[model samples]
Target: MDNSAQAPLQTAEDPLFIGGVGLKSRLFLGTGKLGREELIPEIVAAAGVQVITVALRRVDLSDKSGNVLSHIPVHVQLLPNTSGARTAEEAVRIARLARACGTGNWIKIEVINDSVNLLPDGYGTAKATEILAKEGFVVLPYINPDLYVARDLVNAGAAAVMPLGAPIGSNRGLRTKEMIRILIEEIDLPIIVDAGLGVPSHACEAMEMGAAACLINTAIATASDPVHMAEAFGLAVAAGRAALLAGPGRSLVAGASASSPETGKLTAFLEANAASG
Candidate 1:
């Protein structure tokens, strides 16, 4: 094996590095087809995601009063992603272009070979990561949470792996939990749960299970109350992870639900409250 191939695996102690930028928050947000740009900042603030995903080719320089970029605050770093490209070559070209446009070193490599399903070809993902990492770009590969694929990505110099919970717009919760679990269990690198997270709980579950963070967009943007939902999700992710760190309740063998009140039940508590009123 080449000496370069002997690069050690990543560890949790080390933060996710995207070129020169280092993100503190694990939750990632994407700027996709969702609308109401006014609500975007509010939602981003509510969710407390340190890294925000932006597409390279989709950038409409024609409208450049810095309209889109201006809306985003300076504090939250931008993660330029290759969302529209079909092949690794196209994705690489777009990534480089986006890096130049945004002047950001951190790039999320998204090589979606399957346009219809929008699946990340493991081969394409690996290729992109290798090429980008070689170019000294802080590359984060958005891939399916396959254990082998994820390991390969990390080995290929990926700063992080972003595995989808479900399809991009499906709003499904952890459809690939088992795969995510495998990645979390094995890789020392940041395993970001990206896409298909519908609610805050989904994010929390991923984090609690040892995911470095999660990415969300459609679910938050489409909520009846987008801003409030973002806040709620932030709290939920924190709460779930807190529970994990604090240690969850242990299970015991039982014939029935052990959660039943020993002293009083819900009916009794309601009756007491009613009497007091």
Candidate 2:
């Protein structure tokens, strides 16, 4: 057996720090669009995801019957999102309600005034982040990846900033790559690339670009084989992170750099071609 083929897994490295919480998995999974609640546990395990996002409005009634919360593994951290909130005030209310569920105080502030595209309102998100952070909630605000908005979020005491790669559930991978890259360059907080990531490769691309994490939902849950897709995403994220740590090579605009040694290079092909000509 080739010893080189048996390299160790990359997840053994230091845990990702977010809002003073150390998380082992950088891939944050959203528990939405999952047809059945029973599948969440297996999906989470398959994805090796430490943080799972859930919407407040989706929770089953408090009658202790068919509650989605019961399905999630207790070990995984819950990050409840303000999906139905359209303003900062509304977002704050929903966040408070989510906290009342006895889930830890991790909140993903998503204040969307635009219903058609479902784009997060940067100002409203910052506002909610401020209110939540002061209230002792670990705030992770979803935004449009604008540098100014990110600055505002940091000032508002955001633990991390979740920037959209594209519109929510569009399955358009990295449409806002440049903006996300700008956030990564400028912001001090962890930049989590969330939403619109179509496939495993998209998550891999975001991770390779130095994103602190990738939050995905529609892509995995809607797949024909959700469990396998989850596993694929987990592996892709790990490989991309490893590649980032390995320090990828520099790019050239219009030139090729030869890999093989120039000395005693294969002249046989050239000579044969010349003879044939």
Candidate 3:
């Protein structure tokens, strides 16, 4: 079932499930990058993403007007991410804030200690996932594609697991596809391709490779036309999935198909003589 690179696809009627929510479109969007707040609703309506990912940070409890949560539409399920946390404690604190802020009950847990480049600290991410899951939050830990780490997260009661393609903002395709494939095979949770996917093909490839969904931001928001990119990516994810279902030709050491001559076709040879116009 290898669908690495295949033809384009259009959106279908089926929906993918994320933590019991049926997403109308498998194309997941990130809310951190784009700024044309007016176009967000239109773009989301256009893109058809049921699960939208957002960052969770301090809300400055004093400033009653500091409500970042007001920007998103009510219909979409907000999956808050611990994008700026340096450790498990910080992530847990942010998760609490997110749970307080949003109406939903899920957190996309990520513990990135470094500022230069946000890389998930495996230890911190694992710890945060474990703690948050125990605390009654649907912890969706964004971590490396380590099968054992994923098993540990599942044991910790995580709702789902996210693995990166490269680093955030790198725009690189799946540099860890083999490891991710291992995770896909070994784990039972939904695998969302979280970061460094530059194009729709990347997301579609993730779906074709057996990932449940993908989280895309830099690619869509940074594009020249974000709305169109979103639509394109939506189609791409669907297309890749169709290919996965359609299946592909097997590769093996065997004789290929060989063409042969026609069996018998002399009956029509004299028909031209009878046609006297």
TM-score of 1: 0.80
**What total of clashing residue pairs does each candidate reach?**
0, 0, 0
Candidate 3 lDDT by residue in tens digits, 1-277: 1123221232435556656665656677886667665566766766766667877655577875634456667776788888778889999998998888647778988888778878788788888888887888887898888888898888888888899988898989898899899888899888888888899889889989988778888998888888789888888877777787788678753543333243234555566657773
Candidate topping lDDT: 2
Clashes of 2: 0
Higher-ranked by TM-score: 1 or 2: 2
Question: TM-score, each model?
Answer: 0.80, 0.86, 0.82
Candidate 1 residue lDDT tens string, 1-277: 1112211211233344555555445667776765666666776666665677777545466775435576676666778888887788988998889778755777888888676778788889889889989998889899988889888898899988899999888888999999898988898787888889998888888878888777888887788887787777767666665666787786775734656555455457787689677
lDDT (0-100) at residue 60 of candidate 1? 65
Question: In TM-score terms, which candidate is top?
Answer: 2
